[model samples]
Target: MNRSGKAVIVLLILLAAASISLSGVIYYNLEKEKSQTNNLSVEISDIESEKARLEEKIDEQKTELSKVYARLEQNEKKFKKLTFSIDEEKRKSQEVVSESASLRKDLADTKTAKVDLERKITQNQEELDSFKLEIAQLKKVKDVLQAKLKELTGDFDVELGKIVIGPEDASSKSSPRIDATKKKSAASNLEGKILVVNKEYDFAVINLGARDGVSVGDMLSIYHKGNYVGDIVIERVDEMMSSANFLSSNTKEKVKEGDKVVYRSS
Candidate 1:
């Protein structure tokens, strides 16, 4: 062999070795880049899952807040109702107090009126007692006057014939004759004395009866101490007793027991 041919063979061998080393280095770098890309994609997916969970918790908190607001509104309405009830009770209490005051005033006025009525009753009773005392005093004075008049008059006891009747006659002869006739008529009339007086019936029982010329329908005059008391009409007559009814001219004077009953001149 020649020297120049040997140098060309060595140069071709060196170029082939350099090309193989460059190809191995490029394949190793490409595999390492692919593995890094896969790891990055997995990390991004995990972050998205965590965000969805956080959003769900926020929605639940909002729903709870709405419930709390609703309860607060209901409590406010209850407080308003309680306040109105308290005001109504206070108004009713005021009305009851006013009515009690009015009733007490009326009761006090009624008590005052009752006291005045009692005072009037006492005054009227005292006046009635004073009037009764005055009447008793007047009765005593009248009795004294009646006794004095009786003492001044003379005794009137006499026979029936001696008593004058209506008018006197001028001549003594005519006077005797008239006197005789009057005596006969007077004797025929009823004459008696009161034995008992029945004030309730306004009647009297006489001592004279049919035996003394006394008969029913006979008129008699009752007298007390020569003063005319009343007139009587005979109702019944027996042998010694007669009953007569009194006819009053004055109501104040009453015929009593032991009064004289004389014949009335017709």
Candidate 2:
């Protein structure tokens, strides 16, 4: 009875040890699997966060590209404006150059005209010397005649407002007498249209008179359109009108109605 009880007790102890060892191994394996599962969950969370960050970065880049595009469009508009300004300035420069060329031609023509006028003036001076010499001879003859008249009449007789000698009677002097070319006057540079013209009487009527500072004896230059026609001497002046006699004329033109009249002198 004792031996059988001892053997049964030993077998029960052995079975209990094996069962505990098996339970310990299963617990360890389960714990390791649980730790691996937790690590996987954390990795998934990290991946999701990374994806969100990447999406945000993409949106930021898109916003930046839109800004760049807007700036490019504005720059293009500025470039167009600059190009237009340059073209406009170039056109204006060309016009100015053309005007400069025209002005140079006009200056050359004016110089040529001045040379011709100077030549004509020299010709007139030669004729003036001849006339002055003739006048000197006439003065000598008049002096001899005056001496004979004084001897016959006992005294030299003279009349009022009449003189035998003129104010410019220095014949013995070598200096020449010169008539000056009348200069243009600012106050007398008035212009008016002719109201009437008379070829037979050689007279014309003008609109400007005393009220416009025009008086009798005032010389006026006449022009048909812009071309020179003649000159006129004022004979009568009314309140707002005047009558002028033709004093001179161009060989090819005559004073006519609607012609412009201004102050003139030779």
Worst 10 residues of 1 by lDDT: 168-177
Expressed as tens digits, the lDDT of each residue in 1-266 for candidate 1 is 68765554554444334434433443343343334334434443454444444444445544544544454355345445544654666665755555444444544554454455445545544544544444343333233323323322212122222333222211221212235455446556645677766554566677776546676888888888788887888898754467788777362146766788898766
Per-candidate Cα lDDT values, in order, are 0.53, 0.56
Clashes of 2: 0
Q: List the residue pairs that clash in candidate 2.
A: none
Error of 2 at 116 (Å): 78
TM-score of 1: 0.30
Q: Which numbered prediction scores highest in lDDT against the true structure?
A: 2
TM-score of each: 0.30, 0.30
lDDT of 2 by residue, 1-266 (tens): 59866665555555445445544544553454345445645554554565455555546555655655555555556556645665678665666656545545554554555555455545545544544444443343334334333432332122211222332322322222222322223328678878766554467778775546777788888888798877788899854468788765441246666788888755
lDDT value, candidate 1, whole model = 0.53
